[model samples]
Target chain A: MTGLLDTLLAGLALGAVYALVALGFVIIFKASHVMNFAHGSMLLLGGYLTAVLHEHLGFAGALAAGVLATAALAGVVDRVLLQRLPQDPRAAHVATIVTIGVDILLVTDLARRIGGDLLSLGDPWGDRVRTFGPVTVPDSRLAAVAVSALVIGAVFALFRYSRWGLSLRCAAEDTEAAALQGIRLGRTRMLAWCLAGALAALAAVFLAAFPATGLERTTGQIALKAFPAAILGGLASPVGALAGSLVIGLTEAFVITYQSDLHVLGDGLSDVAPYVVMVLVLLVRPNGLFGAKGAARV
Target chain B: MSDAAKHLPRLTAAVVPLLVLCALPFYLESYWLRIGLFSMAAAIGAIGLSLLSGTAGQLSMGHAFFLAVGAYGYVWFSGDPGPGLPPVVAMVLAVLLAGAAGGLFSPVAGRVKGMYLGIATLALVFIGHHLMLTLDGVTGGFNGRSVEPMEIGGLVLDSGRDDLVVLGVPFGAEERLWYFGLVLLAFTWFTARGLLRGRPGRALAALRDSETAASVMGVPVARHRSSAFVVSSMYAGLAGVLIALSFRRVVPDHFGLVLSIDYLAMIVIGGLGSVGGAVAGAFFVTALPLVMAKYADQLPLVAAPGSPDGSLGPTEASRYLYGAAIVVILLWAPDGLHGLARRLRSRLRSRLRREPPAPPHGPGPAEPVTPAPTTTAPSVPVKEHTP
Candidate 1:
């Protein structure tokens, strides 16, 4: 009973992180018909930035600096690389991969420049592990869950009620029609990239903070697991992303905790375990658990 | 073949590599020979990837998984002690097992394409890496298992012998490995060339152009796509076996997502659908890094744990190089080096003469290049006819 609760709690924290990453993907895909392969890398950048800021500059400053830095990077990357893609809309996919390539290069260089022995968010949460009923989860995990939920709720409200959100949606639904309606696509896309970068940064920061200070290749591995969640939730559905992430998170936690010797399976598989569930779900429902079908495409 | 490719004007151009290799043992140092041998193994893998990604239009971010399957599968099939079977049998079995794995994984592709498909392949790489580390009974995991030294007709090659080394320096088992790698390269090249020029290859290319249209035109899109995956994986497997034989060992770290990305990068650099492009891409990528790390001595900013300086490492720069190369090629020559070479050759041939404009085959344009997805087709009447 205790183990199950613990897994669920940890899973929810991780799932919330996945949801944030998936939202980043959805935001870009919705706005530009562009799949940001750099989404994960962006998240990594955010985490690393936060780590540098928090450890080297202090926590409050790091948080602000990470967001600003990533948003700037995202805007520049979007404008310089993705903006000049071949006119043929079908060519967007190829261009997307290229942008991803660029992001990878950028992140790698950054990581190299900020050389360190290990990766860490450099948080001081470990000394205080609190217990509630059957669950004994860390403060950081609890904090991540709260933050993710708050962010998701805020974004949902903004999209549902705001005029700007409506305009962005209209643009995503029909680029030509939206252009005629006077929607500024450049501004909308720029906003989307900035928001996406912010979300990725927040996720990476909280995720790194929860367990330890830094990350390794395992950080990207975590981001990779979010693919299934993104797929399952419907690539365009933010609500689906959150839901799908929970399912994936719980599934991985359960499987590893109960199934065969996990130690042998290696740490890499644990990072990707949720993808197995995602793949199985996709085999049955291709559009995803909550994908709005045609509405998801531009 | 294109108009230029049809006439074999430069047969000696192709024979030059064979000549160089035949003479290389005498001139080059053993260390360089070893690098060349490794390059050949990687080339074979890249050629296979080029077929799957370039010709078939399927992107795999986890080909190293197939390579791992081939390597570990070979080791398992060999005698339980490790390096179980004769090296040749192990190699062949690896190919078959890899094909089987590809076949099994193919169905998942039917449900997804683009980044989703890439996700699946990426999953495979992570899974394979884990399996490599965990399956200690067969793979020997972190410690790994080494291939037994070569035994040619009961005359065991002396591993400790210095005289047999290629360039007055001791090469150990590399000489034997090179011979094996060359044989496999020949086989890989033959298979890729034949497959790319055949009906299946055409079908693959057609599907790449437009999947729904390809299906409408009676091509079995799923089957061909799956089959391409299978064949490409088989090539990766054989290459893996060669790699294992070369190292006489296999490690989980050896077949990771980085390698998968590197393989994909090579095919892109080489040109998507050409066998020659694959070889050229492989050599360029493999050689550039080797030359840079050794001769250029450019250090990576962050030294990976194993490095001496704690400053920068070759491995880190290698990734940076590949990532930058991906961007450069995509932005400039989306068609890759093969595309660049073809264009250059065409321009060179036409440079001297101000020939009269040739009659166009389709649209009567002066330039006969067939740019895909031309918007201004004779289908103007369809728009007029539409309500």
Candidate 2:
């Protein structure tokens, strides 16, 4: 029972980080209709920035800089590259593929710079653990859960009341209708990308903190796990994304913890457990759990 | 002009290139021949991907999984630890196995659409990788298994075989494999073209344009979608067998998501929905890094393969170029290199005829060039939903 509880806690922490990244995917897909494949690289960029600058600026200042720089880069990618494409139905698909190209370039450059060396982000919660009864959890994990909840709550509130959020929601509903209603689609989309970028950057800190060795070139790939998370919830649904992340996180944790029992499936099943869950889920619900079933007009 | 008179130039154009490709192995060194082998294998796979993603309007990120199935299947079937079948039979079975694997996954493949399908297929890669690593008996685990050299009658496609000289050039494994790759490529080209022009191809294209309309038009939407995937997987399997033959060893790492993306880049760069484009894109994507690595020392900023100074390497340089190419091509051209080449050919033809240049956009005067139905026909009017 205690072991299960421990695994559950770890899964919840993992889910929180995944939620951050998955929410980024949902926001980008909602506003622009383009899946940002460059998101992993953007997370890497933010983590790299924090790692490199933490020594000089301290952790907080460096993280702030990283978040800002990443947000700016995301905005620039949208404004400069994606926005320049001709307005057409295929444009969204084209833009999504273009993000893959951007990811390649960014990952290549970052990997070269980092080489085989692992760099620490110099976060304050270093190897510290907090105990609650029989449950002992890393401070970073607790911090992750706390921070993610706070950020996600703020975002949900923004969606509920903020003017920019209202415009974003309207644009997501109907682009032409929102435009006629005086919403600047370009600006709204760019801001959405920026917000996603910031979220990705924040998620990077907890991802590289405590239990993880440090920020490495392959760290960005961890963001890929969130793809299933985002897709599992349905691309357009934020609440679905959150629910999906937890399910994926828990599945992965349980698989890893019970590897001996599931030996027939193979070693290192946890690495791919999320994907297995995702495929099973997709088989059952093609549009995802919360995805609206779009009716064909013609 | 008479029909034969008008067709003479086109026939010559095709034959000349064929003759040149056949003649290449005799002149080029093993280094270049190996590159050609890899490119041909990639071309075959890219064509398969084009049929599914470009022609059928489904995006798949799980291509590498099918390729792995082919490679490992060939190894297991032909090698001692497993079935120990004939190499040729093993190769055919491997492709069929890949098709069966696709058939197994058809439940999801038939239902998932567009971007959702892409993400759904992503699961296959990871799951496939996991299986490859654990199923040590068949796949030989992480180190993978050595591929058995293909034997046809008396001729062996291996370097250890009896040496034969032709035209003062000693025929080696590379030389023998060059011809094999050529045959496979030619087969791929012929079959892919036929499929694209045939009834099934039209049905698949219609399905891609709009699911509802295609179903209304009596197209078996699920069947066509699933069959397209199966056919695509079979081609990937064939390509995998060729790749394994060339490589002599099959590792789990080679068949990863990155390779699938590389195939995607090839089809996109070459021009989506065209066999010729897939081939061109394959050559461009596959050969670029090898060529760059060979000339890395002379290049401006590119460091050699493994310099410790952290400078830009040839592989990294090629990646940057192709990555930028995908973005730039999509942004400006959208139709890719095949489209660009077609436009250029049309312009040159019009100029030679002493007529004014064709309009900047839209199809040029219908030449006797390969009929690209996807290019001329308007795409099905269906609004894409973000599900």
The prediction achieving the highest lDDT against the true structure is: 2
lDDT of 1 by residue, A1-298 (tens): 8887888887788889888888888887777777777777777777777776677777768877887788878877777777654434444555665766776686676667556645666665644678887677888898888989999888888778887678779987778899898888877887888888888888876767746656654465466677778877887787888898898888777776766566555554665677677767767776678875442211
Candidate 1 docks at the CAPRI level of acceptable
Superposed Cα deviation of residue A64, candidate 2 (Å) = 1.0
- iRMSD for each candidate structure, in the order shown: 6.2, 3.0
lDDT of 2 at B361: 51
DockQ of each: 0.41, 0.62
The native-contact fraction of candidate 1 is 0.40
Q: Please give the range of 10 consecutive residues that has the lowest summed lDDT in model 2 chain A.
A: A85-94
- The estimated TM-scores of all candidates read 0.84, 0.94
In model 1, which regions exceed 4 Å deviation?
Answer: A32-35, A54-58, A87-93, A96-100, A113-134, A158-187, A211-221, A259-269, A292-298, B1-8, B79-83, B149-176, B298-319, B355-387
